[model samples]
Target chain A: MSVLDKIYEKAKANPQKVAFPEAENEKMMQAAYETGKEGYIKPILVGDSTRIKELIAERGYEESVFEIIDIAEESYKNDVVARYVALPHTMLKEKAIGRRMENPLYYAMAMQAVGDADVTFAGIDNTTGDVLLAGQMIIGLKEGISTVSSIGLCDIPGFEGSEGQLLAVGDSAVCTNPTPEQLADIAISACDTVKGLLDWEPRCAMVCYSTLGSGQGELIDKVKEALAIANEKRPDLDIDGEFQLDAAIVPAVAAKKVNRESKVAGKANVLIWPDLNVGNTAVKLIQQFGHADAYGPMLQGFNSIVCDCSRGAPVSEIKGNVVISAVRAMGQK
Target chain B: MERKELEAQIIKMVAQCYNADEAKLSVDSVFGEDISGTSVMMVGLVSEIENELDAMIQLSDAAACKTIGDLVDKVEEEL
Candidate 1:
């Protein structure tokens, strides 16, 4: 099965409440409809209730197939505001709370924070910053996680390093230039996500411009330090790095480059890039030139399961994200 | 580090973060209002400060700070 197919199977079996804050968008609404129809998730659409109902009717879909949360409704607004006020010393104070409640995305997140929803899938009509800020201020980060990072699940044909065709490339959509500690956190977050969604023992390669002690520079040092920190923090996982892309995924390169025998040397399924520029560029290059399919820019390190879809993503991509987000929510449960 | 030294470092960091002049960024300069710090910039600032002080600063505490001095005070408190 494809990774998404497996995730769809798992999600369909134990469906979770996944909220789509950009429910007003045509693509998002259609994806939500499909997600609910396939039993992959129970989609909660957060937008104008009447308009959403009209759209459902217009689209020939059952209104009961999706639950709509209208932020404009006085009662629902009051409930979200009340929930925001009740959180233990919430960061969203009076001024922030007023501003946040006006945005449906934050309201949707507030619902997740208060257990009214399970997960939030958004960013269709909003910037990544908006989605991330709402998530951080409302749902907050998981315990001991100080930073929020993202991972792109790449399915590259002819890429034989990983167990399947999938590889997790991280800090692609966040963390422009991560410090060593933050890089370590990104690795751990990616590992947790891979294990949860794909059910694989993540072998991470902290990719950089250098491989082992082959080169020396500030960038290489940063990757090396990150590797040490990740190793010290999680001894159970197989992770190594300061590896060049070739050394990371090709067994021949791994055998020639370093003396130490490493499980993740050539078999790394999770490639933690040194910076956002490198990660983002590499993934896009692969997608364009190599004809690989990249599934996510999945937000990680949050206490709750929240995923962001590119604003230009199609209905199929949105549906895939809902299933992936549902699978993550199931893992969390 | 002395409080003044730490304060200087923070002003420089915040100024760099906002792409403003260091001389204009006083200790009382609010991060979001006076200095224009975004959530992404805040994360970078927290990392920079932590590395400088060799101490952990809670993001919640940092987010609560209204000014550079408030951040310095939190760092002092942590120390």
Candidate 2:
């Protein structure tokens, strides 16, 4: 099966409540409706109840398909806000938190934070900043990860790698220039995302400009430090790096350049780019030249599955991202 | 490393992150407004800076860094 097909299968098999805060946006609402109808997710529409109902009528979808959360309901808002203030370590006053809850973005994140939703899918009606800030201020970051990052799954038709034409690349959409610790966070997040969605063993490679000790510079040191930190942080996973793209993916190149034993050398399914400069450009090239379908840049390192989709993404692409988001939220606590 | 070198590295990173001109991004450049950055982008930059300095930056402290200079000062204090 194609990687997307596999992800679709997984999402269909285990449908989760993927909440849409931008339910007022017609395009996003329609995408959420279709996603629900297709059984890829049990989409929850979090917005004004009457408007949402009207949207459902206009869109001609069954209202029962989604569990709609009425953000306009004072009682529901009170309960969510009370819970937010009551959560340990929450220092924000009730009035302050209530003001934030008025925004659907924060309300949706609050749903996921309080266990009412499995995934908080946004960035359509909301800017990337609004989504990220809401997620941070409400759900907070995961333990040990200082910041959030993302991972993209590329399915190149002709080129077969460790996963048979599917390769996961990361930090392509976030973390412009990661330091060693942030790189480690990206690598760990990428590993978890791939393992969650694709069920792969996650042989991740820390991609760099050089292979092993073949070349040395400040850039190479950053990548080398990232690999060490990742290995130390998630000792259970197979993550090795300080290799060029060729050395990371091609067995012959790895054998020639990396003269030591490694688990992820050449046989890597996950490619963790050192910085966003390399990452963003590489993925664009893969899509343009390799003609690959790059699945995501799925946002990671949050306490919940908070996805950030492109603002200009079409309805179909938006639904695809929602399904991918739901599939990733499958095993999260 | 001198604070000047540290400040220069931060300017370089902020420039690269936001596609802003490095010369224009002073330590006073407000993160969201000045550099056209978002909360998400700032996290990576500050956390990376924290790691570089091996400084412990609390979440609240990180949130308080509105300008690049504020972040550098926080890092310096922690260092």
Every model's DockQ: 0.06, 0.06
Q: Any idea how many clashes model 1 has?
A: 0
Q: What's the CA RMSD of model 1 in angstroms? A: 7.9
Tens-digit lDDT track of model 1 for A195-274? 88888889999998888788999989999998899899888888888789888888888899967988888888899999
- The count of backbone overlaps in candidate 2 is 1
Best by TM-score: 2
For candidate 1, the TM-score of chain A alone versus the native chain A is 0.92
Residue-level error in angstroms, candidate 2, position B56: 25
lDDT of 2 by residue, A101-180 (tens): 77788788877777788999989877786677677767877888867889898989898798888999998987888879
Docking quality of model 2: it rates as incorrect
Candidate 2 segments exceeding 4 Å error: A89-93, B1-79
Quote model 2's TM-score. 0.82
**Residue-by-residue lDDT tens digits, candidate 1, B1-79:** 8999989988987777567889888998877678863465675566556555655575778889999999999988988
